[model samples]
Target: MKTVLKYLPALTLAAGLALSAIPAMAQQPAAKAGAAPAQPKSSPAAIAAAKEILSMKNASAMYANAVPGMVEKTKIALIQQNLNYQKDLNEVAQVVAQQLNGRQNEITEGMAQVYASEFTEQELKDLVAFYKSPLGQKLITAEPKAIGLSMAFMNSWAQNFTETVMGAFRAEMRKRGKEI
Candidate 1:
């Protein structure tokens, strides 16, 4: 469960990227430390188009549980810091979750901002048009399953490789008169 929790943000980001032309957009090299490029200024039209594309992909649904999960994580951390406040922390978590309900749209909006900044208004318009087409619609339906299968395969491969690496480590350590 803890592992699953830790990977939730990655999964959410992956899901969003999987739904967009992120691979192409990611071609540029990352910036050096403290030298990140500024986000391009997005026009309202560009933002709107980005929002439409995101809506077609149902992006907000991916983060539907985020608010509640964050509240719970914070509550647990607070409880850990002051065990005597566990009950109050739990109550506060519920209140915070309630207050933040439906705020998952914030994630959707932020993603739209990223898309809008990365692509021109015309490009975003083109994306919306593409999503409206039959082939694009088919991709929208198929991509999630493809991503699921890919993740499963990668997990299986990594698990099998883990033992191989562990054995190699042990062998190398034994040769050095040290056991690991």
Candidate 2:
């Protein structure tokens, strides 16, 4: 518990940094004034696929599960402590969300630049509409969970892969009478 508490701030900071680094669609520059926004040429199937992929139920559930662990690790004692804990967590979450949203905007803007030549204005409008729907809203709201899960999965995989590669390297070095 104490160890978890000791690392909480570091972990939170790392998470914030990681979230802020993601590329989003909104970060791209707009076209010349009076020029139309470029949109992706997407079919109904494609739109449906995007909507399905962005489901927030799973993300919300995962967030609900993980938040309690974080709160517990923080070790708040009373109503005031709990309130403070909530406030701090909410503040940090908002910051991370903004960073991630900025990144998303950047990516979208870049995509717009690329697909501008390929897609029509209406297609872009449709894509934006889909993104602004209730489902889209849910996905945006639940982004933190998705980010957290992805980070955890990647970190675990990288750790295991590094250990395996390093272990093999050390073993080979030892066999060759070299310092590992």
Candidate 3:
């Protein structure tokens, strides 16, 4: 009986550790099953048409332009701490610009594949024609402003939704004798 009592605490600790590990173990099969195979490369002609459409749309420039603002926002705390932040930020921006430029081809190629797969060759040609027209050109120019407005609206909506949902969650947790 004395020996059994001595080992009982160790057995309980081992059981607690095993129970803590169950969530991690449960995730392994889902990860293996959910991975998809790599897609084959797009054809050269399709790649060319996609490139033309992407250039007309100026997609890469839009993506690259967004990075600097995002990076600056992320570094706000560091900027507050240092007086030489302008110089540091400029250098970091250059490096980030270089990296974006370096990856531009890969990004463009991926986008081209999406275009190629989704649209027929004739459709892509028609799109190129449209983009070359005055209306399409206007759309290209106006898109950034439209996107900015859309994002602002969505952000306001998300904040309100998150607050409402979290308030309910806290209430439920409190009812269960747990506060989060």
Candidate 4:
């Protein structure tokens, strides 16, 4: 489980980049999690275009901490379950982080492969052209904040609606001569 968790970020980075529908390069070995699901055979031109697209999107930010974060999260989880090892785990965290340094490319490469597989050479080139345009630059700059604000809005809406639903339930229950 620990080993699997260690490599999960690579998979997550790949998936996350795809879901972000914007970004960089990333890939890993099969031992990472499992055999990567087969990707469509992309032409060299397509792959190169995809790589350029990812670079322009600054996809590295999406995965730069993945390896270190994995190490830290694992260390914390271990320390919690083995209280006696807390000190040792904390001491080893830096060593672990160092050892795993540079592995983020694994994620970025896989992400690039995904983009390459999903888009044809022409499409990837078109995307690169778009990203190079002023509007594309604006999107790259603004999308993350937009996503953050959208999430915040959704959370607030859910919280308020949850309270409204609870109030409605309570009112219905009261008419039935019960208090909740």
Of 1 and 4, the candidate ahead on lDDT is: 1
TM-score of 4: 0.74
| Model 1 lDDT per residue over 1-180, tens place | 345444544564477566555665587677788996788789999999999987887776667788898888888889999999888888888889999898877888898898887788998899899989999899777766665666767788899999999999999999999999
Model 1 regions more than 4 Å off: 1-33, 166-180
Top-lDDT candidate index: 1
Model 1's alpha-carbon lDDT is: 0.80
Model 2, backbone clash pairs (residues 3+ apart or across chains), number:
16
Better of 1 and 3 by lDDT: 1
Off by over 4 Å in 4: 1-38
Model 2 lDDT-worst window of ten:
53-62
lDDT comparing candidate 2 with the true structure:
0.50
Score every model by TM-score. 0.77, 0.35, 0.48, 0.74
Model 3: colliding residue pairs = none
lDDT of each: 0.80, 0.50, 0.64, 0.74
lDDT of 2 by residue, 12-131 (tens): 434533443344334667578998766655565544433332232222222333344444444344334667567676666556554444333333333234433343445545655765
Best candidate per TM-score, number? 1
Model 3 has an lDDT value of 0.64
Ranking by lDDT: 1, 4, 3, 2
